[model samples]
Target: MPEPIADFYAVIPAGGIGSRLWPLSRADAPKFLHDLTGSGQTLLRDTWDRLEPLSGPDRIAVVTGRAHRAAVERELPGIPDKNVFLESEPRDSTAAIGLAAAILVRREPDVIIGSFAADHVIRPAHLFDWGVRQAIAVAREGYICTLGIQPTEPSIGFGYIKKSSELIVEGAPEAALVERFVEKPDLDTAREYFADRSYLWNAGMFISRADVLLAAIEENRPELHAGLIELAEAWDDRERRGPVVDRVWPTLEKIAIDYSVAEPAAAAGRLAVIPGHFDWDDVGDFASLTKLNSHGRGNDLAILGENARILADTSSGIVVSQTQRVISVIGVKDIVIVDTDDALLVTTSENAQRVKGVVDALKLTGRGDVL
Candidate 1:
C-alpha cells in the first residue's frame, strides 16, 4: 500500500526578479523557472514535485507577481487556476506570506501550511519529507515550526537561529526552543556561533496552522494582519480584489517574515526549530550557484572548448549558446564564463557577488537589447 498522505497545504513564494542571475534569469523569466541544477527540471518544478507526497496538487498554492503568472502556469501544469495567487505590485516576503495566509484562512482555517521559497534546491527528497512531517505535527500543536539547517560552514550569507532548550518529539529528533535570531554575521562572529554549536542556519522554511500564523501576525504586525483579513473577506467579491490588493500592499510595511514575525514569536516563547539535515542551498546569489552546481575533479564545466584549461576549486560555470561555437580558454582558473546568444559574462569567481552590479549598469545605460 502507498504511504498515507499528510494533511497540509504548501505556499511557494516566487516573486523575486533574480537580477543577479541575469542573461539567463531575466525579468520576463525568473530564476525559479531556470534549471540551475541542470537536472532538466526547473527549481519551481522541483519544489512542487518534492511536496507532492505531503500535500498533492490541489493543496499547493503559488504566490508570485502578475508578471510571472504565465511562466508559473506553463512550468507547473498540475496546479489549478485558482491556486495561483498573483500580487498587483512587487512587495516584500512578509506581505507575500500574509496574502497566502489570508487565502488559506478562507479555505481551511485549521489547515497546516508550509511556506517555502520557490528557488531553493534541496536534495534527498525523503529527508525533506521527514522534516516536513515532523514540522506538521509541531504545527498541529499550535506552535510555529521552522526548518533549521545544520551549519556546515561559517559562511556569512545566511541568518542564524540560536537554540536554547530541547524538546523531545516522539519518533523524531529533538526540537529546540529558539533562543534568538541573529542576522548575517561577519567572519569572526560566524566562527563564534560555530564554536558555540547552538546556532543553525535559518532555511526560511516554515510550517504552521492558518489560525496560528494569523494570530502571530496579529500579535506582531497588527496593521498587516488587519489588511490581510480585509483582503480575505473581499477576495470573493472579484470586483474588490484589484483595488483592495493595490491599496493595501503599498501600505503594508516591507519586512521579512523572520524579522516581523519569527523573531518576535521566538521572544514570546512560541517558536521551535526542527533539525534539517537535507542538502539545501538557497542559491541566493551567483556565488551560491557555483557551490550548488555540478563540477568534477577540477571544477570545470567545459562546453565547445577544445584544448582549453579551466581549473576551479569551486563549482562555478555555465555555458549556453544557440549554435555551435568554438570557445577556448588557456591557463584560466576561478571564473564564470557564460556565453549566450546575444551576451557574454566573464568575471572572476571572487567577484561573483557583484554580478548584479553589471546588470544595474546595463539597465542604467539603457542597453535593453542585451538585457
Candidate 2:
C-alpha cells in the first residue's frame, strides 16, 4: 500500500431535479433542498452532517448548477464560497464530478477526493464513516474505489457491481477488485445476483486521488478533459472564468462517470470495491420514501408530513400532504397521494417509477410551475 494521505476532500454532485418526487421537489426547491423524510433537515444538510466528520469542515465542496448555488450554500455553512463549483449548464454526472477533480488537483495534486450523491440515504453515521475510511484506504493504493452496499432484497432500480476477488490493503480487509458493472437487471437476473451474493448495489460513491481521476478522464474523454482544464485554470479568476465557462460547458460530452471512467478503468485493472456493511437506501421515488418512513406501524400507511391532517379509513398506502391540508382516503390500498398547493399526484406504489413519466407529460404541456 502507498503512504496514506491525511487531508481528504469530499465532493457532492447536487444538480438533479428528482423528477420522481415531483411537486414537492420542484425546479426551485429540488428534493435535496427539502426534507422528504421527517429528519428535521434537508437531504443536502444531512449529507454534509455525515461527510463533514470524515473530511474536515473546510475540506468539503459541492458541485451544483448555477441556479442552486445559493441554496446549497445556505444549507451548508462554514464552506468557503469558492469551494462550490457552479456549472453554467447541465451536463451529466461526468462533468459535475470532473470539475471537482480538476479543481482539487489545482489546489493539491495529491489530495484524496470522494464523491457522494446528495439524494441518497444512509444510516448509523459511525458505520458509514467506517466504509468511507476503507474506501480511502483502497484508493490510496492507486485504485478507483467505490463503496458497494450489500443488497437487502432483489432491487431492479439500482445497478450492481460484481466482486471478482479480494485484495490485500492496509486498513481495509474487506476490499475486492470490481470484476464488472452490471446495469439494472431483469427480475430473474436480480434474484440470481442477490441469492449468489456475488453482487452489491453500486452506491455511486467513489474515492480516488485528484490526479488519478483526471488522468482517467483524459484517457477516455479527451474533449471533456481539455474543457475542464480550461475551466479549472480560470476557477480562481473572477473575470475570466465566466467567459471561459460559458464557451466550453455546453460543448463538452454528455456522459456519465460510470461510462466515461469507472467501466473503462475496471477493464484496465484500476478499480476496486469496498463492501459497505451499513444500511443504505437511494430514496429514488415515493415508494422508497414510504419504506424509509415506516416505523413498525406496518407499511399499511406511511404519512410523511403532519399526520394530524391525514385520515385513513380502511385504507393502506402512502400520503404526503405538504400544505397540511386534510387528506382523506377511503378504502384505498397501495395508493400514493402527494398533494402540494398547486399540484396533486395520484398513483399506486407499484407504479411509482412511472412518476417520472408524469413529469415528462407536464413538460410537454408547458406546466413549468408545477414541475
Candidate 3:
C-alpha cells in the first residue's frame, strides 16, 4: 500500500448530469451516484476509494451541485462537511475546479491540488498511484501536470494531448512538456494522431500546486479568478459564505478549464503531461458501459441488477433493469435495453452517443418529470 503524498489535496468535480447515459442516469441522480460497472460501489465511491489512499480522507474535497449535496455527502462519509463545495448552479469545470483551488490555496499556500473527475474509471490502483506520484513530482517543480492516458486506439470520442520534448523533472523522468490540447477530431485525424507516439488521450487529470493553478487561471481568466478569489475569501465565514456564493457564482463565466486554463498554460510552456499507464474510461455512454460489464462483453450480453434476468436467443447486447422484471430479446444484435420504473431506453450500441438527444427532446416537450 502506497503512503499518502505529503501536502497533497484532491478535488473531485462531480457536477455533470450525464444526459447520454439517461434512464439509468438522471438529473437529480447522476451516473456517478450509481454503480454502472456492477462493482457494488458507486462511481463516486470508487473515486474516493482510489484517491483517499493518496490524499487521505481529510485532504480530499468534492465540488458538486447543490441538489446533490446530500447524496454526495451520504456517499463519501470520510470527507468533512466543509470539504464538500456545493455550487449554486453548474458553472462548468473552470469555476468548479477554480473555486476548489482558491479555497485550498487560502487554507494552505504550498498545497499541491489534484483535480480528478468523480465518474472516471481507472484500474490497477497501483499504476494510478505511481502516475499520481509522478504528477505530484512534476507539479512540485512549478508545472501544471496532467496525467495523459496512453491511447489504445484511434478514438474520436476523447480530446488528445500533443506531447513535445521530454521534461527532465528529477522525480518524474517520463514527464513531457505538453505541445497543445486538441479537440475531438474527425475519424481520419484521430487515426493519424493514434499512429503518432506524441499524442495521448486528454483525461483532464491535472495535478498542480493550488497557488500555481490559481495563478494560471488568474493570468488567463482574470474575471473568473477575481470572482473565485472573492468567494474563497468568504468560504470559511458561516454567515457570509451563502450570500456571497449566491451573488457571485451565477455571474461567473461558464467555460471549461481547458479553455480558461490548460490551453493558455500549454501555450506558455507551463503545462506538462505525465503518461499514465492505467486502464481508464469515462463511461460516457451505454456502449462504453457495456464494455465495463463482464457478462455484457464478448459472446452474449451484459446485465445489470442482481435479480434482473434476461431471455434472449442469438442476441448480443446489454440489459439494465431497476425492477425485478425479466427482459426478453430476440434476433436483436448490439441492442441496449435500460428498463427503469418510470422510463425505458431501447437503442443499439451504435446509437449510444445520440442518447443525449432524447434528454433534450424531453426538455423541449416539457417532460422533465421523467428526466
* TM-score per model over all chains: 0.91, 0.96, 0.98
Find the number of clashing residue pairs for candidate 2.
0
Q: What TM-score does prediction 3 earn? A: 0.98
- lDDT of all predictions, in order shown? 0.80, 0.88, 0.92
The predicted structure with the larger lDDT, 1 or 2, is: 2
lDDT of 3 by residue, 1-371 (tens): 87888799999999898999998999899989999887898999999999998999999999999899999989988789889998999999999999999998899999999999999999988899889999999999999999999998899999999999999988897899999999999999999999998999999899999999999989888999999999999999999999999999999999999888899999999999999999999999999988888443565888888678788888887999898788888888889999999999999999999999999999999999999
Please, what are the lDDT tens digits per residue for candidate 1 over residues 1-371? 22535558999999786877766677777789888776877899999988877887788999998988998998998898878888877768778888888887888767888898999999999888888888887787778989999898888888999988987666446677888899999999999988878899999998888888888888889998898888888776789888888877778778889988899989988899888889899877756676666454335653322223333333435443323555555556655676666777777657777889988899899996676
User: For this target, which candidate reaches the highest lDDT against the unseen true structure?
Assistant: 3
lDDT of prediction 3: 0.92
Q: Which ranges of candidate 3 are over 4 A from the true structure? A: 294-297
What lDDT does candidate 2 reach at residue 134? 89
Please report how far candidate 3 places residue 261 from its true position, in Å: 0.7
